[model samples]
Target: MVIYIILFGYLGLSLLLSRLNIRSKIEDSAQYYLTNRSLKGITLFFTLVATNFSAFFFIGFAGESYRVGYIYYTMMAFGTSFAAISFYLIGSPAWRLSKDKGYITPAEMLGDQMNSTALTRLTALLMIIFMVPFVAIQIIGAGLIVSGLTQGAIPYIWGSALLMVFILVYIWRSGMYSVARLDVTNGILLMTLIILAFVFVSRSLGGISEINEQLMEQSAALFSPQGSNSTYSPSLWLSYMVLWLTCLPMFPQIFLRFLMAKKESNFRYTSFLYTIVPPLLFIFPVALGVMGHLSFPDLQGKAADQIIPRLLTMHLPGGFGAVILTGALAAFVSTTDSTLLALSSLIARDLYKPIFKPQLDEKGTLTVGRISILILCLISLVIAFFQPASIFQIAAMTFSGLSIFFPVFLAVLRFNYRKPISAILAMILGEVVLILFATIFSGACDTLNILPVVPGVLATILILWLGHFFEKNKD
Candidate 1:
């Protein structure tokens, strides 16, 4: 009952805050989709952090840390900071282009820059394809946390359903305004809880020194760069570093958040926060995983994702545990809401209106956006219900899937590759290679053992270079 009260109370407060912030009726699709392009410094900072961290960082990162040891941290934690560099490189220019031309979706910016309707449609389609899996992973993480906390009284599917319903409600109501406003609250709560979890978990399992001593004695291999179980090779580490850096800034949801800033200067604030805060925030999860291994050494497979929730529920007092559990819920909601909103914006503004109804008015577009949110949420919920894999595995696959776009985005922004065929062919060939490698030849081939993104990205660049040469020869 206390858990329910705290969980519902947090939900109620978030909805109330969203309602209070939405003073004016949404006049157009812009207001609903991008909050009328009016996000300021702190709100932008929090939303970016909230969206980027997600359940992947809280649940997936901890799980991976538990499975592989400190090597996961070396790859992901440090690699994540490189996102600040990506923001400086790609985000700034994209924001300028969006502000100048009233671009709402990534497809719009790329389509206009490339002068190709095909590229626009393909960009939107690829985003939806890769993003749904990520959304599914967030929903799965939420379900696991709730089920673990309730000791399976809630069940995973029910928890996922409940979460999807809540996300659909607030997002369908006010769109990006609600998402951004709620993100601020979620960001603060989650950061506080993570810090507390680190301290509390550390204390619960003796001090940091004692935990270190235990790890050294029990799993000395964890201290090595390759991890206790030799889970990561040198090539795998480099691949993960590239994946983490490119994936965060290139993923459509996060890339679009860069456009949400009220001004270019807002990114400066976001950049500083991204660089300084994430390293501090990641410390807790790495520590949690290391200590969790000591506490629950027998846990294996999907069960690893529940380490944080299990620790909070079993070790902490009732009130504190409930609050921390709410924080976990906040992480899921923050990422899922942002992803649904972004995907809906792409579907409604980019795909539906352009192809089906070129004359879609603002009200019609907003309605379509709302409906798309429901449809996408249901799709993701169904996927989460099946419980495909661990959060880390699903997230990594999604990142690799989306990394196919990185080379194209870079070409559009920096390389000035203006040929639409180059972008289109690159996307087609890149996706085909990724699908083939991931499905047909993943286990059979030793070369792909590093990571899928490495080959996926290489395939994309190869196609782009070939297309560029052919186009140049024709000219």
Candidate 2:
């Protein structure tokens, strides 16, 4: 426990370095939210990747890999690489637009483009509603990490509460500047430790042949695509690819990242890296989870979610799990900070000022944004504490819900694609379809092991296409 505390304290100190002598002017929203758009090169690269990834990258991936098999790798890699391509396709153009129009938030850009305050508020509300679960997943990972590190001396709720408070204070200190700086360090730390954890565990298992021999003897189901429990159906695999390609780019944290590029080349350089790097990093956790079955094959229920941590602590030397978990803690904190910051910006700029408090000045808006951070932290923590779902389940639901906004972004970037009403109808019907499939007719939704996002994304595009066609007919 002391070792875990010391390593985590070191991680905390590294994050604290972001606040050292970093003086940010919070009197203006753009300056606070975007770091004055000065991000580029390594800073931009780390910031975007770290902000885009969360505990979901490690905790969720490993857990799913443990549940299914390495086939989990295919969906995330292909899907996310396509999602990365959007950095050039959707992001570069949007960056230029934001630069020209002085737009800061996604809803602000969409609302102004379509001339609809209602759409602005609706988009903002939905993003927040869907994103909170994603945020809760971070807290859940942190809570699990903390409990594991302390050997259950600290309960999950208290662990989650600690992470929430830290994120709030960190954001209040210097906004995006601190968050970006923390991400630079955390990003490197997480990448290194994940790879290290993989090496250490694999070595302990006596390399590939032994692992394969053990797997074939004890858990042959791992080599199959249907997974140990037989959940990874073909439709579900394709659904994951589509979901990441469409949904990841629309995440408020990721969308906001588009507006922060210091140069056009930032998109080019980062796009290539984004396509390749995330997928490579994903392989380790998934492999670790698969290998984990060799040690603990009978992990029933949610115990599988703890596969990576259990593997690290039980297999490796003392204090090693502490170090790796510190990386885990950093991954969670890095994600929650960016997520909370982006959501606060959306609520403050898009909803609060325009809808309720039109007279708010820049400073007042900043204050509102900070306060919203606190409220959102509380809300996310509450959800984290009571969450009955696994990280993958929560992630799947949130990703699908947020993906409904893709058509709106599609119409926004392709000027010829917008008939404002068409975009609005597309977004609304997309969400409605998503809810129906996920709930009302869920049995029907699951018949072929299909996911709601598949239909949701298709329905969204179908509406947009129909709107475009009718407009041409009327013309």
Model 1, position 404: C-alpha lDDT score:
83
Best by lDDT: 1
| TM-score per candidate, chains pooled | 0.94, 0.93
Alpha-carbon lDDT of model 2: 0.80
lDDT of each: 0.81, 0.80
How far residue 34's Cα lies from its native spot in candidate 2, in Å, is: 1.0
* Best of the candidates, TM-score: 1
RMSD of each: 2.3, 2.5
Query: Candidate 1, residues 170-255: lDDT per residue as tens digits?
Result: 87778889899999999998899888988898898889899989888998876778987677888777887777766777777788
How far off is residue 413 in model 2, in Å? 0.6
Indicate the residue-level lDDT of 384 in model 1. 82
lDDT of 2 by residue, 1-475 (tens): 6675664586578656877867755668777888877788888889888877677676778888888777778777767777886676678877888888978888888877777787788888889888887888778778878887887788888989977877777789589988888889889988998999998999999996688677778777777867766777888877777777778778888877788878878867877888888678888888898898888887876788888888987888768777887778778888889889899999999999988899999899999999999998888777776786654465667888888887668767765464667777888899899978988888877896888887888898899888866754211
